[model samples]
Target chain A: MSTWSPSASRDALMARQQMYRSIREFFYTRSVLEVETPLLSQAPVADPNITPMQAGQRWLHTSPEYAMKRLLCAGYGDIYQICKVFREGEAGKRHNPEFSMLEWYRVGWTHQQLMEEVAQLLQMLLAERFSTLPTLHLSYAQALQSYAQLDVHHCGDQVIARHGQALANADLDLDRDGWLDVIMSHQVEPALPHNTLIFIDQFPASQAALAKLANNEQGVLIAQRFEVFFNGMELANGYQELTDAQQQLQRFKHELQGTQRSHDALLIAALEHGLPDCAGVALGLDRVLLHLLDAQSIAQVLSFEWQRA
Target chain B: MANYSSNEFKPGLRVMVDNEPCIMIDIEFVKPGKGQAFSRVKLRSIRTQRVWERTFKSGESLESADIVERDMEYLYSDAEFWYFMATDGSFEQLGASSEAVGETIKWLKEQVVYEVTLYNDAVVSVTPPNFVELEVVETDPGLKGDTAQGGSKPATLSTGAVVRVPLFIVEGEKLKIDTRSGEYVSRA
Candidate 1:
């Protein structure tokens, strides 16, 4: 194909447009107000795993999470935004350096409540290709135990490393959270049930990015976060917002350690100004469209993939 | 030696793993939305030719293997080592250890070009041509008009590699042999 040509077919692009319209309609009927935020920000997210693309003096926002949360703090209720997010060094069959993300927040909602809403939207959007199926809910610990034979809450670092190395078939030098991430993405995600929406929630506390910490039924501390998947591919990640400003600042500092970057002080300031309790989720729109169109690769649904762009 | 981070990993890149030179066969970028990133790679060991998978944390660096492949003409083996001369007009001769020569020694033909893989100036492996033309050194005499039976018999090539050829094939005739499977193709 010529370099000027787009990666997706004309038909695929049209389908994507239709999906965008359907998403807007879905939100419109529910009275969820749509909003926009700047793509570039003075400060990027503090999560070291997600690298933000730099543009001149500013960095392209990895997500509109901070800005959207600031809006929620400013008294915007039940808001949604569909925008392009940039993450450096992430490109593959299912990922691009720049991709579309649909993020939203609901006041006084928990991650569990947000998960049900996500299921409703997905069922409505994918009605043409699939019949509505029951959503499956599994805790992060349950997934690790069932798929990788890992007990994340109770296992030592060596045990997690052993399972990860065995699954990868080679040695892996990783920390506890690193090994857990490896097993989760490589083994557990692929082993989840297909043809239905699946929610894996209550992650280990160390991995809780912007989520509140809560005690589970067994009195073990867990992150109030959840991820949705279909056909073993992760589509969305949701979190019950951490309303404590001091705690949020500490978490950001912990993540930004060993890096030269600083946290988003504006977001922390907004958190301190009496923000209401909320839950938010960010969904990868390209992946959702890929699944809706039954496409094998994300590029097949993108007008111009990173290579062509 | 130069180093490569996980972000630079791709198929066909050779890197040192566990003190051995291994070539990457496949690579996949794996990361959770809010967790650590990893690069999962499938690699084949240069010495053992065994394939396995390994995952590396993002930003982790690996030393690049100083490996090179050269076109060389097979000379002869001296019990302990096989020798070859570079075909690049340099006429540089190099001796390969018995382990490096491995099973490809059975397909070695004098003056025939083959690929010699070297790591850090040491011969690590050799690859023979996919198809080689060799004269049959030993076989039963062909029976006239025996082609109709469609029977096959074992014929020893000049390189001492035995292959099954049609019953009509006669000794001293040059035949095309597939080096990979050690099977006869047809008369050269």
Candidate 2:
């Protein structure tokens, strides 16, 4: 392997730069203020799965979620940031330990509106390849039924057991949300067609993370969250903001899997000070670039994936 | 043998699964947003020659397969068993399982030794030289003056592997064949 050379070609790199420039323009037209946040924090995220790279007493930021939310609480109406975030033990065709993320928050919009905006932005960015890319919406239940032919809410237990049978270990031990994610990521995401913006929305309430929960027309409690997948890659995840201080604290605890961080208290305080009703999202910029280039691996769009770095 | 953590996973690594030694063929890291991470992997069992997919929770460890690769030459088989000898003159277990021989068994030409992969003292795989010269043991008589550019016919080699060769090639003619594909390369 030529480690000395950049992972992406000069032409692809130029396209990336152009994509970045166009993204800024897209937000600028909407009057979304571009903002920057600290790359490291004194406290780590409780989300046990996302192990943050630590530097002595401080930990590198996983995503600008908490800090960006703090900004939202400080009354920064519509803001966006494109920055590099760090996560440990993630490397492959699509993942690098460190990757670029484009995060933004809107004061008066819902995740649904944000999803439409995302589709519009993608169409703007990929105008050269696609004249008009159609956006497809699928509720979490519809996605499972369409892709794996299983019901996420009703037949969850049996589906997990059957899905686990294929695994080497830890079969059927995971919770409902865990099984949904495993099946969704491995099956539904990649099977999505090219040039279509697929929005898988209304997640299970248990896996809500920081999103707000509401009942769908079917009366099942679902989280107001949606994920965007393009050309078989998960490009972005967004949520209708959760502003209840107590609820936010509980979600933070649930995210920490087992680790505890002092920032949880600070975030709770911010929520108590009142984060405005808003929707927010963090998109993987590298993956978006990969989709635009129609490249098989994320390395083709990134200047230096984890390997080269 | 040493154990391997999920972070150390890569292609070509051998690890035991359910007491059978399997080689890691492909692996991809998958982590759902804000959820448990997993390494989806594909493995081929040397004992059964069955390729299957498996998933492991991140941070999980695997037992080493105690596998080793050595340069060896293919020896004649005893009908039920195929044998090979290392370049250093050391004899292998004297019998290789059919599963270990794989499809390469069709191209196994005696005296044309190959590099063999072993696990726990049993031959699990053999790699033949890219090109091997074998006499065509069976084929229709060449059409008197058929040139190499004309039609082709099936020819059986000394290894019993059939390959399509130029119409000019007839029985008893030595031909070079690609062991990997069991295809005719050229007249030797």
Off by over 4 Å in 1: A1-4, A126-134, A167-173, A293-296, B135-156, B164-174
Q: TM-score (0 to 1) of chain B, per candidate? A: 0.91, 0.85
Candidate 2 global lDDT: 0.83
**Residue range A196-221, candidate 1, lDDT tens digits:** 89999999998888899999999999
TM-score for all models, in order of appearance: 0.89, 0.92
lDDT of candidate 2 at residue A303, scale 0 to 100: 82
Q: Fnat of each prediction?
A: 0.76, 0.67
Tens digits of per-residue lDDT, candidate 2, A195-273, equal 7888989888887878999999999999999998888778889999899998877776666644555545777788999
Q: Could you tell me the lDDT of residue A24 within candidate 1?
A: 97
Docking level for model 2 = medium
DockQ versus reference, model 2 = 0.58
List model 1 lDDT by residue over B14-94, tens digit each: 999989999999988888888777788899999877898887877888999988999999988888889999998999999
Query: What is each model's TM-score for chain A?
Result: 0.97, 0.94
